[model samples]
Target chain A: MSVNTTPMPPERLLQLDDVHVHFSMREGLVRAVNGVSYHVDRGEVLGIVGESGSGKSVTARAIMRLLSKNAIEAGGRIRFRPEPGKEVEISSLPRDGRQVRELRGGHIGMIFQEPMTALSPVHSIGTQIMRTVMLHRRVGKEAARARAIELLERVQLPKPTEMIERYPHQLSGGMRQRAMIALALSCDPALLIADEPTTALDVTTEAQILELLKSLQAEMGMAIVFITHNFGVVADIADRVAVMYLGRIAETGSVDDIFYQPKHPYTRALLQSIPRLGQAPVRRLKTIPGMVPDPFNAPAGCAFHPRCAYAVPGRCDTLVPEVSLFPGDQSARCHLAGELPEEAL
Target chain B: MVGYITKRALWAIPTLVFVSFISFVIIQLPPGDYITAYAAQLRHGGEYLTEAQEAAMRQQYGLNDPILVQYWRWISNILFRGDFGHSLEWNAPVSSLIWERLGLTLAISTLSMVFTWIIAIPVGVYAATRQYSLFDYLFTVFGFLGKGIPDFLLALILMWLGFTWLNMDVGGLLSPRYESAPWTFDKVLNLLSHLWIPVVVLATGGAAGLIRVMRANMLDEMGKPYVETAYAQGLSERQVVWGYPVRVALNPFISTVGWALPALFSGDVITAVVLNLPTTGPLLLQALKMQDMYLAGSFILILSVFTVVGTLVSDVLLAWSDPRIRYA
Candidate 1:
């Protein structure tokens, strides 16, 4: 994908080095994202699973530098490689300057959870898509319009010519989501950040959208940073999974490693919480104790200590747990990550 | 869209009839008829008209009939014969007096409305974009001050300052020399010179209110996900703002088009009186005060027509501009 004499490796597509996003609200400084780090190789699907207030979406926004005005990337950097041998430090760019703006849809397109609100209510889906194609592709209006119809067709919308002229309100919920996906894929960004994209969709529609995204990612050969709260979605779509909790990565491993052999307490708890068909004897679903800690007054030591069932008293509360490595590149941030027995976990 | 417009227009017919009835009833709700107010005025001016003369006057003006019959006569003349009855106090046909001042009133109101928008929209946008900055704070203060100051008082101060410091002829729509002059380039120029004073006075409160409205609307729209989507499209901040939020912010502006024409006549009542401008505000005020039912009723009916027409235009524009509203 490089236009240079020397080609760089595809593994370096995107790298987050100790990313810290803090919001300075009136109450206090909220560490919404405290030192998050992950990487996405070209054409790889990385699922980030977390509950509400887990900072997964915030972390994805930090990657695109699309945080609120009160928010600041307190420290660390986001290194993005749009093409081989062309590295850009996204965290250093201004929030809305030309450089960051170029990095936005031109190189790193994003889609939100609510497709209803993501597309402009007043603008036609065609105009919304055409503007992107025209801006990034530098094409004429007619050509841009043609590309918009092509995109709508590619996303499997019937009667694309009619769809192009229709506004967001005229379309069904699922159709609007598909149109949003089309708009995001307009310029073919190397990395796509989908923040709970399927959460707002019904199950059948969500499955269709997931299938569409998977096929599109394969065809386009672009990396996807798929952020969702659904573990089931992660198992079906992701090759790799990064479980986040309380603004930090609790664990990062392959789908098999996360689902079958989770190293973190939070991940284990999460997996057990998912209702299985034959687990009727345990009729009550197991829920993680307590809630995600408030950002204004977070738990000391391990951020997840307060909610961690496997947490050791003084060791977990007094000292912060560092990342513990495991076999097959699996990693977890917990004091007793490797020491716990399989039965106990 | 054409069907929608036609439907809205048809709906306004009943609205006009209902409004006309309310206006006529309310106009007559006072102690006595126009003859009573006129005779009281004559007595105050030391010209005593006996009860017999008053009764003769009432009969001549058709004011002694049943209220409904009187209403039917007044309305039928307006609808069938294009007559607005007679202004008992002014002693002239209501149509003649209204048509003469209607042009100037429309001009002033239209100009002031335009001026209000032209100034307010940009300032509101700037304030919202640079929210909480010194410029935003300054505009906040400016908006509050503008909204708080009474239009008539502002006109008075501006007039005094114009006469004393600038030495400009400040009040009235035209110079005394051109007051009775027929339509000419010079008279038009003279009218324009005095026009800005009342326009500024009338627009001040409106612009101030609209600025805050635009700012709040823009702020709300700016927070929407579509704005972020626009930014993610690699559009410049300026493009993202103007193309997305600004258009949505202006829906309220489009809705205001329905009432704008009537506000043109009614918006400057106090300020026009203070400035002594030749507009319909004072005439409406006098017609109401003197219980000149025909003149008052005609004014309200004409305003109702303008309102109905304006609302239809506004509804069409709004539906065209916002599809969500069209469906709604």
Candidate 2:
């Protein structure tokens, strides 16, 4: 079959079409990513916001094909645009094949949550960074070394030449993360995946890392799928946001639309939970009532209905909600999407 | 590193002295001297030992000396003259007696160690990578059986099979022709042909235990985030498994090498006896049985030295291999 020859505009760099990831455990099948669909445009920072067990990280790993041994891609596709009008179905690629291998740290790169454990303790930072460079590029040792140093400099790690030879343990958490980012950007990937990259750092270090990522994205014009639980972080860095709840996308819109005009009851509760600056001192901050249901025996119908205060009693608890598209490229998964107020904040 | 090694070597001196002293004390714990056992053997042969002969024996061996004086004499001879004393059982110098059989024992033990590691490493890597698979479960079962069955019993079974089914003589480390022959190429080849019997007998239990240890270590290393990190780096599965987790897994395995070395030389006494191999194990056992204090004590001391040196070598190797274990 001939490929599409038309000079089509590149709208979205990566798209997940109703992807479902399940983990087969001794207890039961865990619905990790249940028909979650979203698209990340070129140079767009798509923030995936969710609490623990909300399947945001799993979704990121699915795109990267870095899920654990137990995980199963039960359904749907992760279609990545290689170039304008050209797409590759990541879900169809073998987990350990050359295609996925090239996709990882080549066309797409990932930086994990814990910088301390993300880099191998035995190898020097330069060697680890050079691994990506050597893997994706056809360069000799000397050239790869030069590129490694250049990447380190790009990540703004102090004394790139000297720091390249140093091990991960020698560097501070912030510096280690900088090195990790250098490793991720070594191949100049079209898309970057940051899975809670700053979760393990101090608040100050987290801000610095966020600043570095923003600058790098702007400099390279690369799309980023940033997974985090912090709404503040999404507000600061994200252009578009996808709010997930119980393995499904509850809402996807512009950051302002989700934060200021949250249609889903769950998103509104999450926004309420964050303590705003200059707010009155209170004994307790707002929290969604119930926990993420046990995945083995997840609640039926609308997963958030149990915890949602504005849940339609019989309707929300009994019937599963469908995606409702609004006028401004915003969508929500709720039965009362039309009836609910546009601005809850 | 040189300073650290020197410190370790210096520390070993007192430790070996204490170990030798303990062996001396323990050897003396048994009732009566070697003469008493000799005299009893004579009685069993229908020849009574008279009071005159008993007195003569006591005077000849300096049995009248105090325990501390005897110990001092023994230790002094070892320290100053480099003599390990005369063996009452063989009536030969301890050093010469050990030296006669040392080569054969070393060859067998070393070969067994090589075999154990060669087989165990790959099997361990396989079992760990294919964890919970049919192959892993089968190896696990075999591992337990190998560990549980006594080495002597296995030796006996192997001997029976070699003799009855294979129609082979599976005793000793040399053929009849090579037993008295010089160390020529043909003699060495003959020795090699017979060497496998004892080596296989010894390595069965060792390789099984080692395989289990290596598999456990690999599993642990595989679970670490570093392994996943390598995978995320776009490394091939082989590269990720061997180059990353297996390298780290080797630390614990290398540390066990010290204990393994001494065990090869001194351990598996029952297996040695059953196979009738001309190694130190049978000699040590006989010395202890006949209350040959000097010979038994020397054997214990040598084994202790092997233990110490083995541990030291493994420690240095571990420090060299694992960056996490840097010595001050």
Interface RMSD of the predictions, in order shown?
A: 1.0, 1.3
Q: Candidate 1 — which residues are off by over 4 angstroms?
A: A1-9, A277-283, B25-72, B181-189
Cα-lDDT of candidate 1: 0.87
Candidate 2 wrongly placed segments (more than 4 Å): A1-9, A83-86, A159-162, A278-284, A342-344, B1-3, B24-81, B183-186
Top candidate on TM-score is 1
The candidates' DockQ values read: 0.74, 0.52
Report candidate 1's interface RMSD in Å. 1.0
lDDT of 1 by residue, B216-245 (tens): 999999999999889888899899899999
Categorize the docking of model 1: medium
lDDT of 1 at A102: 80
Q: Provide the lDDT at B59 for model 2.
A: 84
Best by DockQ: 1
